[model samples]
Every structure is written in C-alpha cells, then in structure tokens.
Target: MKALQLSAPKQWEQIEIDEPSPPGPGEALVRIHRVGVCGTDLGGYLGKFPFFSYPRIPGHELGVEVVAVGEGVENVKVGDRCSVEPYINCQKCYSCERGLTNCCESHQTLGVMCDGGLTEKMILPARKLHPANNLSYEQSALVETLAIGCHAIDRAHVTEKDTVLVIGSGPIGLSAIEFARVAGARVIVADLSQTRLDFVTEKMGMTDTIQFDGSEADIEKLEAMTDGRRADVVVDATGNHHSMRRAMEMAAFGGRVVYVGITQQDLQFPHAPFLHRRELTILASRNALTGDFARIIQLIESGVIDTDPWITHHAKFEEVIESFPAWTDPESGVVKAVIHIS
Candidate 1:
C-alpha cells in the first residue's frame, strides 16, 4: 500500500506501507476510499498544526468501507459504508461523563495524534463509526468538516431567530452558514475577498455578503443587517487571530462568539467594552464528536445540506505530492480537495 506519510514538519512523501489487519474486538478495519484535505493538512505539512507529529499518516475526514469487523462488533459489518468520528477519547473523563466526548481528558485524534486514513486501510473503534444509507465516499469524507459548523452552532446555543455572522467564505465558514440557516437564523458571511463572498452569495444563496475592508460602510451595512443590534452570534472560521479578535467587537451585545479555527498565537480581548456591556460567551469548538458526525450524515441525507461545490478538487493518491502545493493556494479556490485511494 502507498500512503502519504508526514515524515517530518514541512515534509511529506507517498511511502509504500503494509496494510492494517482485520478488526480486533470492538474495532473495524475500513478500506479508505476518499480522504479530504483541509487547512490542517496544509498546516501539518508546514509544521504549524499544534498537535501534529512526524511519521503520521495524515487524514481523518474520510469515506470508508468496512472490509472486516472485529469480534463483538455488531454495529456494522463488511461492505457497510460509513464516516468516522476521528477522536479516540478516554471514556472515563469528566467531560465524557457529561457527553462532551470531544473534550475528554486523554484525547487521541487520528491523523494528528496517530497514524490515520491517508492510506489504504485503518482499524478504528467501532463506536466512532457512523453509518449512512447510500452515502457517497467523497461526501462521507466531508462529514467531519461540516460537523465543525454544527459543533459551533451547538456551542453557541443559537436558536432559529438569531442573527448570525460567519467570518470566512471558505469551507468551514460556508459550513457555518448552512448550519446557522438550519438553526433558523438569517445568515451573513464576511470575507476580505470579493470572490469568496460572491461565491457564497451568488451560488450558495447566502443572502448577506460583506467585503471586509475595515471601512465604515462595511460596519454600517453589517449594523443594518442586524437591525442595529449587531450580530447575535459570530462564528470565526478564518482561523486567523486578527479576524477572530475583531469579531469580539462585531457581535451583538450579550451575544455569543464561537471560534472554530485553529490559531497559534495567544489571543487578546477588548477588556472595558467586553466586560461592561454583555454577558458574552466565548467558546472554542474543536473536533467533532461521534454524535455530531451522525447528525452531519442525517443532515446531508435529508437535503438540509448540499456539499456539491464544497468538493472543488480531486487527485489520485499518486498525484498528491504534486497536487498538495497547488491546493494550498487560495488562488486555486480549493474549497475541499480529496485524494482517491485504491
């Protein structure tokens, strides 16, 4: 088997490797069909993702087919199609006790914390697998990313009537738009690039789009969009510290702000205003839980989610070395790029 292995920071190679064995008890050996590339992979390649380590098989978001099932794994069987919840959590933690499995004290994430799906096969805990009827492999690979939007909305406690602002037009940002809409909020998206804003508005049917130029007009337009109250909820999908910090001032008084992006710097918050006025809730939404992965599958199945344009690029496994760099550039408009594994 040929797997894209991250041998070190800023280095990756398509190295030949042995295939994983059939499932052990409570596990399933899955043949990976599609592996989605995201900012994390790029960050990992650049040696920027916080938890990334070398020699890691870098993939998590995937569409996998069950090739073999371990003893006592009755939840799924050979030939079943499923998506994965990439976190392996310690079941006894306080957070896990409260159903926040994603925050379990000892958390191991595939791709980053251990060898993952950037290969032909993976042996995963059966409990972390989610089954969907007739789900496409490429689409299944996206459930994790889309679940980021769902998780952010979950943390925000957003209702159907809230005014939400998503501060990015990339895949995660667009995902936030969908789940926000599903939550019944009038969604608005912001970005520095008109091209991304245009893609969201013209093609994605997002009603409000703002060009973030730090101009008075942009702020005023945002104010007007929120009926003079500012955003009731703000989701920063940019993963850039500057944009995320600015959102503290952009949200409505007493509103919630969710940071879905990963950043390396220590973030600062405006004190006086942030302290005096609102009962502001600042949340950091990380990886998806198994349940969120399940919801993502259902959302896609029920027509509440459309990932058609999200999968904007594809490459054969052999072409990853040449293709990875191009997919990293914003100029490529690469929303979601996938590698097909044999």
Candidate 2:
C-alpha cells in the first residue's frame, strides 16, 4: 500500500506501507477512489489548523468503493460506491445520545483527529458509508462538503420569503449558497474576490453580491440589497473573525445567523444593544448528520444540485504533494480541488 503522510508542517512524504487485514466487526474495508481537498486540509498543510497532529494522513472527504465487510456490517456491501463520513463520534456521549452526533462530546474526525483516507485503502465504520450509486466518483467526493451547507441551511430554516446572505465565496460558502437557493431564499453573496462574485452571479445565477470594502457602509450595502431591511438569514462561511463579526451587523431584526465557518480566536460581540435589541438567533452549524449526507447524495443524483462547476482543479494522488501549495493561493482561482486516488 502507498500513503502520503504529513510528517510536519509544510512537509509531506509518500511511503510504502503494509496493507491491513480484513475489516473488524462493524467495519468496512474500502478502496479509496477520490478525495476532496478542503479548507481544513489546506490549514493543516500550513501548520495552521488548531486540531491537527503531525505525521498524519490528511484526507477526510472520500469517495470510495466497498471491498469487503466485517462480521457485523449491514448497510453496505462489497463493490458499492460510497462517500465516507469522517466524523467518528462516541455514541455514548450526551450529544450523540440525543441524536446530535455531529457535536459528539468525543468526536474524532478522520484526517484531523486520526489517520484518514489519503491512501489507496482504508477501514471505516460500516454505518458511516453512504451509498452513492448514481453519482460519479468525483461527485461522490463532494457530498461531505455540500452536506456542511445543507446542515447550515437546515439550522436557519430558510424559506422563499427570506433573503439569505452568505459571506465568503469559497467552497464551503458556495455550498451554503446552493442549499439556500434550494430552500427558496433569494440568495445574496458577499466576498472580497471579483472572480468568485462573478461565479456566484454567472454560474450560480445569484443576482445580489456585496464586494466587501472594509467600510462601515458595508452593512448599509447589505441592507440596500435587501430593500433596506437587511437579510432574514445570514450564514457566515468566511471563518475569518472580521467577517464573522460583520455577519451580526448584516442580519435583519429578528433574523437568524448561522456560523458555518469556525475560528480559533474567542468570538466577542456587543451585548446590550447589538445582539439583544435585534432579538437575534445565533447558531453554530457544525458537521453534517447522516440525514444530510443522504439528502446531498439524492440532490446530486436527481440533478437538482449541479456541482460540476465546483471542481476547479484536479491532480492525481501521486501529484498532490507538489500541487497542493498552489491551490492554497487565491490567485489560482481554486474552488474545489479533487485528488484521484485509484
């Protein structure tokens, strides 16, 4: 077997390793087909991700095929095409006990908390594989990223009467825009990049955009786009502290704000007036649930959600170590980079 390991920050090596035995009980052995490079992977590559550990096989968004199943495996069978759910949760935790597995008290996400599917084969919990018979290997790889946005929109409960504002035009932000539109909301996107803004308008068919200029009037610009009332639902996917704070100011009175993006710094905001007066409903949308994964697969399979444009760059598994740094550069116009594994 061959695997790419991140020995340290800005370091990666391809090494030969022994193949594992058959899957254990409740597990499935999968032949990895494709992996999606996300912001988390990028952060890890730069030694910036807070939760990462070095000498790790950094890949989580996987498109795979079941090669064999363990004694207790039930949901998947050999040769089934699937998407791997990387968030391995402690089913006994308080959150998992209440069906909030995405926020499990002891969650170990692959690629971040443990070795992930960066290699040719990996063993994952059988329950974590979602069948994707209708999607291509490339499309199957996108389910995880798209599910994040699905979970965010579900948290906001957006509808046609709502004006939804999505901050940042990165892959995660673009996913939010796709689901918000599916939820019947008039979507408005804000980003610092003109190219991304153009994609939002031209490809996504979004009519509204606010190119943030770091001016106090940015909020006013957002309000003007919503007929001076601001947005009914604001989903911040920038992960940038400043943009996260501004999301609070761009939401309408009695509106909902879902933070899908995360930051390491403490998030602080005014209490007496800003959050209190507006009667804001702020929420943090974490990783997606099994239902979200299933829904995204169906949406893509039905042709209701076209994610073809999301693949802006591609590289073979062997070429990843050399090509990865370039994707981190914004000027590369990288939307979503996919790695062909098998």
Candidate with maximal lDDT: 2
Worst 10 residues of 2 by lDDT: 265-274
Model 2 misplacement above 4 A: none
Pairs in steric clash, model 2: none
**Pairs in clash, predicted candidate 1:** none
lDDT of candidate 1 over 1-342, digit per residue (tens)? 878898987677878887787678999998899999888888888888888888898998889998899989988888999998888898998999998898788988889888889888878999888986568999899998888888888889889879999998888888788889888988889999988887887778887888998666766889877768889899999989888888878888888989998898889887778734777888899876667888888889888788887888999988998888887778888889998996
Each prediction's TM-score versus the true structure? 0.96, 0.98
User: Candidate 1 at 213: error in angstroms?
Assistant: 2.1
User: What lDDT would each prediction earn against the true structure?
Assistant: 0.86, 0.90
Candidate 1 regions with alpha-carbon error over 4 angstroms: 215-217
RMSD of 1: 1.4
